[model samples]
Target chain A: MIGLYIVTGVALVISFAFDRKKTWAGLKKGWMKFYKTLPSYLFLLMLISFILLLSEDFIIENLGQENIFLGLLFSLGIGSVTMMPGFIAYPLSRILLARGVPYMIIAAFVTSLMLVGVVTYPLEKSYMGKKATILRNIMSFLVAAGISLIAGLFYGELV
Target chain B: MKKSTRNYLLFSAFLIFSFISWLVQYDFGLAIWDNFLVFARDMVLILPPAFILIGLFDVWAKNETIEKHFGKTNNPMRFIYSILLASTTVGGTFVAFPVANALYHKGAKYSSIFTYVTAASLFMIPMTIMEASILGLKFTSIRLLASIPFIVIGAIVLEKYFEKTAYTLPRVDQK
Candidate 1:
């Protein structure tokens, strides 16, 4: 996070040095972009918090007992809806692994958790349009599913 | 409904839900509020600088430069460049989407833009290191390797589909 600040500060300094008017323009543009998206972003975050609070325990409880197909499906479903930082997600996955959740299911959960974003749909659509957002997310879901299966086979969990 | 109105409605609905949860279970409501605040703080720390850098890029980056590397060219190298760039990105998808928007406006091909967004989520260096340390290097390596081909292929297919449908990005309003 500090790295991000330093880099942005350095870039802003250089940009100001090169051209004052353009630097101001850039700052204004950035502010506008940020402001415009602020509402939806807040809404998305609130929704995620609600979902995570309600479902986290339920998901953990249900995830452990399912067969491979059902496990993968459940993981993908939960992963798509909830977003978390790597620190939270990775440790959680580690705990699940210790709990004897299959490697492939964990793989599915981790991949889809990062790649698929149902909660991010509004933000994505604003940038990429509806069709592209839908297509990209659907494709990501499929890719994540494939990755989990491959991981399963590689670990010799699946014959 | 108007966008602003819709957003306001959604926001109100969320607040109401929180209120109801509070009424039902005080702790559950408090937990939800804390979680929201935590995420909001993180976003507040990360997003401003990221957006400022993106704005600078928008103001300074030459379209010719983006086009030469990632434009409509048939070069497979663009995908590699996209992945490389994605790996270095800091602020996750929230930041990635704005950067991708700037790139698109500057003439990057759809395939390259898609690759950047998808790879951005998967390949952040810090995230990968954490995953490796927790999950084992083999698991991390396998997931990364497995992801690359799929990301590339999915990007290409989505690009082709968009092209076939004549899909265009929603117009970003400029004030």
Candidate 2:
């Protein structure tokens, strides 16, 4: 994060040096874009928190080892809809692993969690349009499933 | 209703729901609030610089340059460039979206933009390091390797589909 700030600072300084008016215009444009999207972002945050709170226990209970296919399905389903930081997600996956959820299931969960964004659907649609957003998510879901299957076969846990 | 008004209404409804949940179950409401605070703080810290960078890119970067490298060329190197650029992204897709939008308006091909967006989520350096530490290098490596081809293919296929349909991106007013 600090790296981001440093880069932006240097860029801003250089931009201002080169052309003060254009730099100011750039800043104003950035602010306008941010302001326009602020509402959607707020809604996304609220939805994320609510989903996380409601699904925590349910996720744990459903991702057990009794049924592999069911577990993978649950992982993909939950992971696609929810968004959390990597720190929280990795630790949660570790906990799930300790509880005997197979590597394949965990891989499916993590992959889908990172790649697919059902929760970000509206926000993405606002930028990329509905067709692109839907296509991207669907493609991501397929990729997640494929990667997990490969991980499963590699770990010999799918059988 | 206007889109912004609808969003505000939905946001308020969620807030009210949280309040009701708090009344019924204090812990659940507290968790939601805490999560929201953490996420909001992260967003506030991260988003401004991202937007600023996008703004600068929009104002300064030449359209001809974007077109030369990432535009409607048949060059496979564009995908590589897209992924390489994406790996440098600090925040998640939130940042990537605006950057992708800037690139698009600057004449980048749809396939390249899609590659950038998808790869942005997967190839962040910090996230990869963390995943490797927790999940083992083997697991991380396999997933990364698998992702490259899938992302490229998916982007290409999606681009083809869009082209066949003569689809154009919907323009939201910047002002």
Candidate 3:
């Protein structure tokens, strides 16, 4: 947490320093502008609600019973879509694990859920350009896989 | 960002996602090579409506009012509020994008919006706690710690690229 804060601070300073005028004003004028956009935030909440409702069934079935690979694939698949709130995903995941899901697959699912979502493609395209969005998502997805693989190995060693 | 009024587009996407999710469940329910296709289908269907709503927000929101409050690129508070709002949030990543994008258009700095995305991605308090218990402190800590740099860097890059476009009203003097 602290490292992230420090990094964020440093990055903010460096980014602001590049275009001093825009950077300086962004601290104030920019934020107030964001405040006006609060209603947009609701979209996220709505998405979460939908996922929680829909995935309840999925979670009930697979809890405490997943392997690392399956978890990974589940995460990747879900992450690509962009739905499934952490609230729903985590509990469902825990249940799946308790039921018999492999650790690797659960780890994979968590990574994918957080790292990538296919549904966001259009929005990403508009905001960051299509190529940038695609490349970034791809890299993030790959990282998710790597993380799951390492996690599975570590768990195996510990047990 | 005018409303596309293409209601059918969103409906179609929703139906498609639903079908895909169903297909994934059926194909991999027992075999379990990877059930990603199911989740992907589910998430994709939800985005079209999210996009349409975002388009409306973008078109209707007053840029001036936004600039007056949250348009600061330098203020630390900008960062504070962004993380607060985003980290506290829970939702699908796909749906979150356009809403954030709309805010960006209304003058929210890219850095702030990026923070929102990153925070939202990992903001589940209970989940973190559970992860620590199940996965151990070392694993959870390592993952959380590593994510910070990624989030900060991602936010920084986004801010740089998303230069604010001055919002001017129709037939009004450019301020």
Complex DockQ per candidate:
0.72, 0.69, 0.07
Candidate 2: misplaced stretches above 4 Å? B12-25
lDDT of 1 at A151: 98
TM-score of chain A of each: 0.95, 0.95, 0.61
lDDT of each: 0.88, 0.88, 0.53
> Considering every candidate listed, which one attains the maximal DockQ?
1
Docking class of 3: incorrect
Tens digit of per-residue lDDT, candidate 2, span A46-120: 888878877777778878858798788889988998888898888888889899888889889988998999999
lDDT of 3 by residue, B1-175 (tens): 3222233344355456656756777543222212333444444444433333343344445887555545763665666676666653433344455456556667776676666665666654555776777655766665665555566666666456444443221211012
What's the CA error at residue A63 for candidate 2, in Å? 1.1
lDDT of 3 at A143: 60
Q: List the residue pairs that clash in candidate 2.
A: none
Interface RMSD of each: 1.5, 1.4, 12.2
- For B1-175, candidate 1 gives per-residue lDDT tens digits of 8675788788888788778877788787879887887788889999989989988998999998899899876678999999999998987888899888889999998999999999999999999999999999999999999999999999999888888888788655374
- lDDT score, candidate 3: 0.53
